[model samples]
Target: MSAAIKRYGLGILAIAVTFIVFVVPLLFMALIAMKDRREANRLEFSWPTNFSLVENFQEVLSARKFMLVTAFINSTILTVVSVAILVILAAMVAWVLQRRRSRWNPTINFLILSGLIIPPAVIPTIWVLQGLGLFKTLTGLIFIEVAFGLSFCVLLFRAFISSIPKELDEAAVIDGCGPIRLFFRVVFPLLKSVIVTVIVVQSVSIFNTFQNPLYFLPGDSNATVQLTLFNFQSQFTTAYNLLFMNILLITIPPLFMYLFFNRQIVAGMTAGAVKG
Candidate 1:
């Protein structure tokens, strides 16, 4: 009884804290988004009298000649292509690193893991991309996203892959299956949970990212959803209503994705923690 009380108490406290920290700010943003520009500019925490949500939504989407729509299309393309490549590459690399035993394993692991710690050398990357003729292009940004997101996804995949049995590998090999066939046919299907987790988590990360698109793909036609926030913000005059509405817009897809895949995320993250 006492333990139950303590657990429930802690859970309730966490809920309250989360509500205060996240929900309050989100509610404020929604309120401002629903207000007219004049009331929204006041930035008060009061209920709005004149709701202009539809107006602001339309204006935000229509701003700069439907740039938000274009940004959405660009962001979707970036997220989908980059994440697909990332999943396949990361999975293959993690499978090899986990399954194979080599003297160079530690060195390889260190090199790959270093990507997580290293700050991107933007100017050098740009120079290299320029030499390769990929600068200021979606292709360049896609590569950047893949490189930056690789280490974490590899770690997740490696952890989950470890939980898979070696017996399956041996059985597949004995049955005349090659390495690629073994992975794609037998082992890959078992990775559904972790794959879903990686897809959801990395999708959110890539979709919400700002600086990569801002620096690499500066062309307005290639703008990402995050870059559309600049439409409402400027040097002097800021459209607060439209700004919050834009925030409301960009925040929805990821929020829905996370909520939908919440269970898969937890299960995948904990796949290898307990070994029988």
Candidate 2:
């Protein structure tokens, strides 16, 4: 009876904490977004007497001739392209690094680890992009995101690969399957869970990324979803209602993704853990 009560009590405490920490702020933001300009500007947690959610939504969409729409498209393209490359490339590299033992493996492993530890130098990266004639282009930004995300994805892939049976590789090779086909057909299908994990994680991060886009892919034409926030912000004045509305809109996608795929994320994260 005492243990049961303690368990119930702990659960209740966790629920209360979650409500206070996450739900409160989300509710507050929604309330503000639904409010009119004057009420939202107050930044109070109180309910608004005038709810103008539709009006604010329309205004935000039409702002700067639908820059938000453009930003959304750009962000989608960026996320899709970057994550696709990261998954395929990372998975292949991880497979090779796991299956093949070579003298150069240590050096290559060091570089991958270094990528996770070292901060990317923006100026040098920009210089290289410019030299390659990819600066200020979507292609350049795509490469930047892929490069930054590669190490983490590779590490996850390598860890998971270690647990896979080596017999699968040997059988595929004996059946006269090439390396590319073996990976694509045999291993890639098995990576669905981790792939979902990587895609969702990287997609959210890339979509929410502001600094890299701002620094590397500058200009209104190349604006991303995050940069759309600047539309409601300025030196002297800020459109609080519209800003909150924008925030509400931009935050919805990633929130829904996590809600739906949270299980897969946990499973993938714990995939290579010790069983004993």
Candidate 3:
């Protein structure tokens, strides 16, 4: 009875901490987002006397000829393409790396893992992009996103792949299916849960990423949803209310995605915990 009580207490404490840390800040931000400039300038979490939520959203959406819409489209394209390519490539590579036994496998595995630890070299990357004539292009940004996210995706897929039975592969091979058909038709289908988790998580990440887009894919036309935050901010005076409103709008998609796919995320993460 005492141990159960202690566990309940710890759970309650964790919930309280999460509420204080995440929920409180979000509520404050939402409150500020509904305030007018005067109340926003005060930066208080108190209830607003004058609501300006619609006005703020309108201003943010209409700013600079509706650049936020453009940013949203750009972010969507980057995320979809990047995550799609990353998922396919990462899954294939992970399967090969995990299934194929060779001395060089360790070296290749080390290099893939190293990507997670290594910081990107901005100048060198810029030079390469320029050489490839992809600088300041959406294609360039997609490649950057895919490359940066590859290592982590590979790790997840490999872990999940380990949980799969080797007999499935053997069975498919014996049935006269080529390796390509075996994986796509046989192995890939079973990876649905993890793949959904990866898509949801990485799509959110790629959509929200700012620094890579800023560096590798500059210009107003190529801006992402995160860069749209700058529309409400400036050097002289920031429109705090509009900025907060913009933040709220941009945050909704990913937040809803997580809420919807959270169970899948948890299941996929634990899929390979016990290796067969």
Model 2: per-residue Cα lDDT over 5-88, one tens digit each? 999999999999999999998999999999999889999999899989999999999899899999999999999999999999
Pairs that collide, model 1: none
Q: All candidates: CA RMSD in angstroms?
A: 1.5, 1.6, 1.1
Point out where model 1 deviates above 4 Å: 1-7
Candidate 2 residue pairs in backbone clash = none
lDDT of 1 by residue, 1-276 (tens): 999999999999999999999899999999999999999999999999998989998899899999999999999999999999999999999999999979999998998889999899988998988999999889999999999999999988899889899999999999999999999999889899989988999999999999999888898898999999998888999999999999999999999998899999999888877862
Off by over 4 Å in 3: none
Who is ahead in TM-score, 2 or 3? Answer: 3
| Residue 7 C-alpha lDDT in model 2 | 100
lDDT of each: 0.93, 0.94, 0.91
lDDT of 3 by residue, 1-276 (tens): 999999999999999999999899899889999999988999987999999989888888989889999999998889999999998999999899878779999898899889999999999999999999999999988899999999999888999999898999999999999989998999899998889989998999998998998899888888889988888778999888989999999999999999999999998787787882
| Candidate 2 C-alpha error for residue 48, in Å | 1.6
Consecutive 10-residue window with the lowest summed lDDT within model 1 = 267-276
Top of the candidates by TM-score: 3
